[model samples]
Target: MTQTTILPIDALFSRVEAIFLKAGLNAVQAGALARVIVAGERDACKSHGIYRIEGALRTVKAGKVKPDAVPVLDRNEGSAIVKVNAGGGFANPAFELGVPELAARARKLGIAALVINDCTHFSALWPEVEAVTNEGLAGLVMCPSYATVAPTGGNKPLLGTNPFAFGWPRKDTSPYVFDFATSVAARGEIELHRRAGKQLPEGWAIDADGNPTTDPEAALAGAMLPFGGHKGSAIGTMIELLAGIMIGDLTSPEVLDYLGTTTLAPFHGELIIAMSPEAFAKGRPGDPFARAEVLFEAIVGAGARLPSQRRFAARKKSEAEGVSLTAAEIEQLDRLLDKGLDAIA
Candidate 1:
């Protein structure tokens, strides 16, 4: 029975907000994060949306994430390089504060970087990257997380399932954005398989013994493998350094230690860079968008779709007809709703 529930996007927002509120978020805070979650669903980013909501609430209850946290701008507040300390809160609003500021600085200075530390990221990176590109600037954002995936050729997990996001804008089409996890299989995709009692495909993950396994539960209990083997692992390592050593944020080992003590959201860090072509490239007559559109046409004419075409296609269809969710998901939400709001915490 293909029982799919189709609802307006706002309905999803309201449901997510209600759940966040029940999990101890104020209206403003809940609204801020709710938007991130909703945008994930809107873009068909299943892993970063509903799949991780419960974990976010659990972290809040565990005191790993502070609901009322406010990020403090560091001493280098108003320069080309920007930094914000989240004091161990959600990274959604932190990026909300940093993206626009970074875009502004990049517009004026040609390029700018923003580093946010001591924050927990619970959503997709496209929103932040897209935000910068919307301002007519190129954007690249890298976020390092806890050690869930192992480095290539290593038994134990050494690095986070880091996300690398980049965006380029176009004049006649949607922005070109690519946001992906370095793991062979995304964390949420693994979770979905586990929930459905299905095994993961080959190359996704391995058992605790270092041998690869198709068992989703065992893989989750052990570690995820890097996509493309060492190449992906190397990129993950680079992202860790860029978002950690480069900016001096809490690294993966520290996050693993923090997780050992509590089930809360692990404090993490993010690196965001924005560049304006008006300042860097041919300034007067060179239109970056126009140049990119030519390549886009070439690629499409060659019968190849771009990186984000599927997501853009999905978003268009969803906007017109609405989005669908499995009955199991709705049932889970209903069960959570049935539990008294105060009791959820």
Candidate 2:
């Protein structure tokens, strides 16, 4: 078995940015992608970290991603509602361009909604939501993808994993955040399992024939299941309609069924809503943050683990001991960097 290699966070970020810069990304885009990667790594989200680089590169080469994309603010509805046209590229820089404007509007209006279309979501959503919360606001982020999961009680795959994320600021610690797929597992997670030659948990996926399987290879070639049977399917539906359709973009099934498969991540669009707790509550005693503090006290008093608590712990460890990566994964990255444009786009 290959050993894992650990490196300082700074080193990792520098190397990842260099690789992206070689792959048609501008300095700003490279830094944005690098930050997203570091966030996933320090938070122990391996599936969304360096593991996703090759897949991202493939799409860039395929012309599905405009590495030089300049996402534009299409419309501003009042002080709280906005729209972004992402120029059909990665969502990271688009959010970078749009978030500050939307956040400014939110701080003024006490709430804001930014609907984005024509952007591909390749990383975890929590990072974006966390960004909003870190800037002193509550947030929600969600996106739709190609049809790769079956709804409850049906054999055929009818929906995508449909990721949803939420974030809230905290008084004494890091922000509380959670990001999850409505499907039993994310495609990236399944890919990780497959790469490691590991079996999957029960109810995670089905074979091409629509039969349940614990084999990661079969699961990838087939379909992932909804997480909580009908309940998860329902939430997946809401995300598909809200982030996909309501955002004036094609839903997961629509993208696959009509436009057909494009590349690695055909995720069409995303939705982000930010709200200022102070704006709503005026932040008096026992107000929004204080009330939330009371709730947090009760939760921890009951010995409950808060959302992203593990991630926070992992981040602390990474800061002290450096980030770790498998030797094989390191080799892949090194080779990509060495080959340059020929290997990237």
Candidate 3:
């Protein structure tokens, strides 16, 4: 077995932030990026963890993302829509900037939407959804990625492996949350499989000729399949319409066209909707939180596990102990910190 090293969560965050700062990201961008990345590692979500660092650095090195851009928030008063322009920076900081206002607006209006535009988004959406839940609101987050997944009946890459996430606040314990790629698996998973010299599960992707492929290299060069065929295809299209076109941002195809290569993080927008459960449940039959808990108890009673339960368990373990990384991962972090953008290419 490979040896591993455990580092405290704060220690890992400091290292990640240092890497981004060395790559020229501003304090806001670097700090926010570090928090989400560390959270992913803490929760055992390896696809969004340290493995993503090099791609972010590569984007910065190629000038595809602005390392020093500070996100600007627009309150858009009296409207249900709040806007944050990422100013060509990473989406994490922009989401951080707008979330407070989003929570406040949702409480005041019963529902509100935060529209983040012109951001290079590469992280998982659960962190953002959990952020909303932290503010005692339910949240739904979605974003379009590089054109990577093929539509149900299509042979070419069109729809992205668009990710969607939802979260509900809980009075005790971790919030209820679920985050997943609309594709059979996230593109990051395939990349990880490639790095480990592992073949993908059979239904995950197709080759350039649209034939099923288990090879990661061929899948990367071709197209990923949607999760539930037509159902997933429709939802992916809906994300493109709502998060992309409706928000006046680039669609998946447009993102692929602009990026020219999927090697870098895709430049796009994100949609985050926040809703106040209490406000929605006002003057209703019973307490919404109470009812939700009862439903959760029933699900568990039936021997069904809740979404994100394992993740929360991992997070608890990481908090008490520390994040564990293999020797190679540690070396990679050291190299990234020492070489900055040059470590990628």
Candidate 4:
């Protein structure tokens, strides 16, 4: 594989969008997904960055994701929600559909909760949370997936490394955005480490026998451990109840049905909560956005950077210079592009 410099962010985004467009996505949807990718990179979430392209395209080629499935919303008294049959399309649009509605709902209800179903792989929830934050609202999102995790002490993998993300509006500071998997690390990160033939950090994953293992390959074959041990396990269990049981879109069952085997796919069940500051602030801080700026400054000065700050900085640098690419990764991208071209041919 020949090494080549990473494409500039704009160039990278365009190239990424082209791949999706080739799979039949509309321009708007492509743009939305690109935004998600760029944001993930910017926020230093490399696992969700360009590495996801090939896997996503594979799902598209398998007819698991429809390239043109737009989400439709259901409005009712006091609350509004949407059922996205992304028809096997990308997850971003399905989640993006909630953005405007969540903001509107916050205006009316003071708080709004959105549930997403049949959505494809939604990447980092940070960007979406940040979106609501930018709009002067507090937003929290959680997504549960199928079993790739062994419950705290169990040998059987019975839960997904469910993720919960939150964005809170702060007066005079960047919104406090927290996004993380219930697992010690996300499955995608494990996958990336495996691809790189690297070992995992301590206490992250366990082998099939439920003993900790540093080998990424073993972890992949086995299961990941939850964070904060039992406490985090409880949170993941709660997310499963919220995203799976409540929504009637169980991730494990769906994985079995779709994959024809019990192999897991990181399908997600997501919830987004948007709360307006008008209820709490009582109109004193008229501009919630301005309040956010102040809080951001204060927090940074206090030696606390926003969640994903490192990633955001990296992304900014990358956009100005170029996206980082190892020779191996570039080769992989070329191979993926070739496969995509072959699909059309």
Q: Which predicted model would earn the best TM-score?
A: 3
lDDT against the true structure, per candidate, is 0.80, 0.83, 0.94, 0.71
Model 3 lDDT vs. the true structure?
0.94
Off by over 4 Å in 3: 1-3, 191-202, 211-218
Model 1: weakest 10-residue lDDT segment is 336-345
Per-model C-alpha RMSD:
3.0, 2.9, 1.9, 3.9
Stretches of candidate 1 above 4 Å error? 1-6, 74-78, 191-199, 213-218, 261-264, 283-285, 321-345
lDDT by residue (1-345, candidate 2, tens digit) is: 779999899999998888888888877567888899878887787877887777778877766778887788855756567887878877888788889887888889988888888887778888999889888899999888888898876676778888889999987778889888889887778888999999999999988888998999998778889999899999998988888888898788876775466346674888999999988888466578878888888999999978888888999899999998898878978987887557754
Question: What's the best-to-worst order under TM-score?
Answer: 3, 2, 1, 4
lDDT of 3 by residue, 63-124 (tens): 99999999999999999999999999999999999999999999999999999999999688
What are the per-residue Cα lDDT tens digits for candidate 4 across 1-345? 656676777776776777667656777567777777766654557777766676666665566666677766655455455344444556678667767777887777788777777766657678878888887788888777667777788775677777788887665445577888898987768888989988899988889888889999889878888899989888888878887778766564355455553222355456777888776677574666666677777987999767766765676677677876677766665665556635431
Model 2 clash tally? Answer: 0
3 or 4, which is superior by TM-score?
3
Number of clashes recorded per candidate: 0, 0, 0, 20
TM-score of every prediction relative to native:
0.87, 0.88, 0.94, 0.81
Residue range 32-108, candidate 1, lDDT tens digits: 78888777777787765676677777778766788878776653656788887877788877777776778778988
Is candidate 1 or 3 superior in TM-score?
A: 3
Candidates arranged by lDDT, highest first: 3, 2, 1, 4
lDDT of 4: 0.71
